[model samples]
Target: MKTFACALAALAIVASAPAAFAEDRSSARKAQDNGTRQIPVCRKNLGTVAIIEPDNQWWREFNLGSPEAILRVFVQQSRCFTLVNRGRSLQNSAMERALAEQGELQGGSNIGKGQIKAADYFLQPDIVSTNNNSGGGGIGGVLGGVGGLFGHGVGAIAGGLNIKKGEANVTLSIVNSRTTVEEALTEGYARKSDVSFGAGGGGFFGGTFGGVGGGGYQNTQIGQIIVLAYLDAYTKLVSQLGGLPENASAAAPPAK
Candidate 1:
């Protein structure tokens, strides 16, 4: 009976091996092809919205593009708001209208004012802070200690593959366009301990999220961390607004 029980256990391990291998393969494919595959989606639109970038150019210091671009995609994917063009495309539109007024545009070109749609809400995305290397005790120290037992070469390679932790704080706010009153606010944070440098450095998404939130957010570890943080904030924002009663907005606390 003991022998039969051992046989059953061995068979269970063998049966699970292929399932584990298949899961690993699927995870690798998802990492390479679609890092944002799990982006939240909505069934209906809540309102027409425009993303407003802060006056400060902080994203530039991080090698990132306008935060509006990132928020634009999130809004579109979530289907929570109808996005409007308030960026450079609006300028181009104004230029086209100028040409129409000058008769430079072909006949029947109906470029004019009052055709633009009104925004019902404004979405503001902000990055509170980011730490690319956060945590106590360095990989170098661990490698040095291991080197005392292993050898100098092993320690050198380990040091070259040093991993660091990264974290970011982000926020998303929704405001009523007519009243200019803040309707809701959500904060998000993300931390990663798998960020590595030197020869062992490589991001998971590669080019998956590129051409949308700029190259940095899609390609670099710190940028990815920030994106994750923003995603968290956006998700929370949606959850906060999704199940609220219609009169919820009317119940805002009186200003102190």
Candidate 2:
């Protein structure tokens, strides 16, 4: 009877374990879906917009493709505005005209000069990142001390457990092309934290993992923050342009 009771209890636990795991999985899926859902923000198109590279030197030095990529993707996906290539329009038009003039030689029809659509607004993106250190008194220090016992030569293995934090600020602005007046400004901020772990030192067998490591433009702590900030700014821009009732028809300035 005692053996039978134990078996029954074990079976009950096994059955309940699956249920608990399924509940946890369901919760995680729900959270993930919520985070990925797109918020509908733009209702009407805001006319043609020209994107300009960020003026910040930091952005240039970072060598990350301009935040224009983010804005372009967001605007295109939202159908908020018709994008225009201000820089290439003129050159493309001239080339087209030249091709038309030589159409006979190339056995092609003479195409008339293409009409260039003037941009109604220009968009600019700027980003700034800064590092934040929270001291070395946490589990990192404990781990480092433990690693030290293994030998100072391999101390980096434990040092890699150190925490790193960073913050990013992103700003997007819309300016009227005709009036050169700022129409809308949106800002987004993001904070990111991660553990520092890397392999370096000595020969093939002498490598140690420890110390602060930096990530590439889009993969590091700052990069993650930049991406988050852009998402936030884009969300706000869409909300202002289309989500709110009062701002539904107020997205663009009146034409002079």
Candidate 3:
């Protein structure tokens, strides 16, 4: 009996090995695909770029996760174009043009699902709201339905359930040659936030569905300000030395 138990344990270990390695490989691939944070390369000459790589993980989850990811795309696109002669440089204008012509970027990997550039900008924006804005057990509202599902009580501390069942806009703000918020998204803000909810219902009270089974609507602003600052920092770095190419985008002004 003991020997058989030992063999069973060994078999369990073997069976679980692939699942563990699969996660590791996924993380490694994700990191590899995301690449590093370096200056952007926008050459003077209009031609092919060699690398033109795209971060599959980030692009899949959320394009332009941080400003750095966007910068990577710009540089890679330049590199790939340098190799393939797809374009001469990287510019907001170029990006906009690509969307106009092909409904997506001309050279970079697929970023956006809808009309959004996905990596560099938002196809839509996010908004905030709540249905339990009443008094009394309104505090219980936030903690009631949805909380029972995701099993997260964090929102409960913030005073009732502040929900955002409304829509969100994705404001695709880009840094100009000056590294300021240039090219205000012409298509207006894209949808930035869209979360689903359904949990925490009668189930917790011996009901089958569990908890407040109808936790609807939530929103995250995505804070346009954060994006603006992120772009500014990236542009500043690219302004100096510039490992890739020339000042196709102009140098960022000195900090005060």
* Number of the top-ranking candidate, with TM-score as the measure: 1
RMSD of model 2 against the true structure:
17.3
- Clashing residue pairs found in predicted model 1: none
With a 3 Å backbone cut-off (N, CA, C), the pairs that clash in candidate 2 are 156-209
RMSD of each: 14.2, 17.3, 22.3
Each model's lDDT comes to: 0.59, 0.48, 0.28
Can you give the lDDT of residue 256 in candidate 1? 58
Scored by lDDT, model 3 comes in at: 0.28
Q: Write the per-residue lDDT of candidate 2 for residues 25-77, one digit (tens) a residue.
A: 65434333233333222445667788887533344333344566556655665
Candidate 3: residue 24 lDDT (0-100): 61
Query: Would you list the rank order by lDDT, best first?
Result: 1, 2, 3
Query: Highest lDDT, which number?
Result: 1
Q: lDDT per residue, candidate 3, 165-250, as tens digits? A: 22221122232323333333321121222211121111111221122122111111222222222233333322332232243233
Ranking by TM-score: 1, 2, 3
TM-score of each: 0.67, 0.55, 0.19
Off by over 4 Å in 2: 1-41, 87-93, 102-111, 132-164, 193-218, 242-256
Candidate 1: tens digits of C-alpha lDDT, residues 1-256: 0001111111111111234555666544534323443345655567678898865555665567776767776777656678988889999999998898888998788888789887777888865555555343433433333344335655444444324546666778998776787878987776664333231223233433545744467666677667667777876677666543333234445545
What is the lDDT for 199 in model 3? 19
